[model samples]
Target: MEFINIALSNLPVTPENNQQPSEGMQTGLDLKEKLSEKMKMAVEHDFFAGIYYLQGKYGHTYRELSTSRNLLQQIYREILEYYIDGTWVLLESAAPIILRTQDAKSKHFLQLGFRDLESSRLFHQRGSNIGKKLYTNQINFYKQGIKRVRRARKYGVLAILESRTPVEEKKEYQYVSYDEVRNPSITEDVKEYDRVLNKMIGLISRQLVDATIQSSTRGYPLELDLIEMHQDNFGAIIPDHPHLLNRFLSEVETAKFHERQKLPDRSRPSR
Candidate 1:
């Protein structure tokens, strides 16, 4: 209400600086000021009423916090799909597109001003793990994609291995490619993808095991870590499925040769 009052009070009347104020001008200004104040008060009243309703209806504040998290997840997914396919398929596609649909519902519910808590809750639950992963996977991808776009503005082609971070606080190391990080080849550019991948795998596995051991020593139970272990084990069973590209595996991927699986040396697999 105070915010509303402040905003309303700041409203200005547009009158010529040199013009003298007539009785009619003064009367119109007074009416406008009154109407603006009334409108602000009404808006504030409605806003508080809605909040009160949510407080009464919802289970608790965590439910609302969860909804906010899901909303952010939806936004992340939308932006990710746009980057990956380099097309706004989510912008048009419906039903099967889990994330975009959630985003739409989030927008609609927020626009309607959060009156329908149940609808919003159900909307939040509509999102899936894959949808969440797709969003997470594309963060670095988009950063590289944007850098590529900027370079393309000058160079005719985007340079491979041009996008790289410094190693050990030293810029002296040759720039490593993200492509090499994700899908290394046997060329001089990626002479040792296998060696890198093996080292990364060992490092990640040891870290996870150590973390699990340390957490066990502490009073806090490592439920989430166990769940992650189970998922990783499951993912190993079916490495071909696209769903392995979730946040859980993404960390493993980034820490371990960025999950650069070897392509076949022979003919491409038939569809």
Candidate 2:
């Protein structure tokens, strides 16, 4: 038998500079749009619900609380209406409305009462202890509300900042000191803010690393910086997909191995 020689051409080559992966597959664009619409829904629902609750409509109160599941259901309904022929579907009910409405409405009244207490001279709860009562419950509600609002604003602000800023501009947002020379309080606040923000950054880094490893097999590099910045405030933990990380690591190693094999062997060249 005659020995036949065959030439192999166009061998696959792996690029040396495989960029870092995206932190999040879903950009803040989608989340921000959802949040914008959700805020409208929340404000509307809260406004109406607050009125009805104050009027003792216990049934309506439960429907208006901005819990995660209820908000998600609202979004789901909106999505269905937009994408599925504009027909609305019944969302599954969670807790009984009558009781929740009563409790929530009671809480709503407290917020208004608290706001009133701030300017009033009368002890909110007692004729003689008005100052003390104002100091207690009213102050408590305002402080809690302020904290909640700050947290919400932080999430929205971070999302918008990341979504609009280009990847190359990300370095600017990276860890930076805001030490002001004049104000001790401002310096302390900035330091505390940085501490918490860095923790948030660490969480994002972990998630991005996990995503990158998992997606290597799919031959996609995730936007690590964007992922770090755009991750949900509470969604930093690596996903629980079974074997996803392992599979990605294996794929990356395999790719590296094949890459090494693709190099021309000088010892056997022109044989």
Cα deviation in Å at residue 88, candidate 2? 36
- Compared with the true structure, all predictions reach lDDT values of 0.31, 0.32
In order of listing, the candidates' clash counts read 0, 14
Give the alpha carbon lDDT tens digit for every residue of 170-214 in model 1.
Answer: 234557789877986665554233433343355446552221211
- Predicted structure with the largest TM-score when compared to the true one: 2
Model 1 misplaced regions, further than 4 Å: 1-59, 87-157, 160-271
State residue 236's C-alpha deviation in candidate 2, in Å. Answer: 15
Query: Cα-based RMSD of the predictions, in order?
Result: 30.6, 29.0
lDDT (Cα, tens digit) per residue for candidate 2, span 160-210: 233323345465545545663244343344553455466445645555212
Let me know the TM-score candidate 2 reaches against the reference structure: 0.24
Superposition error at 81 for model 2 (Å)? 23
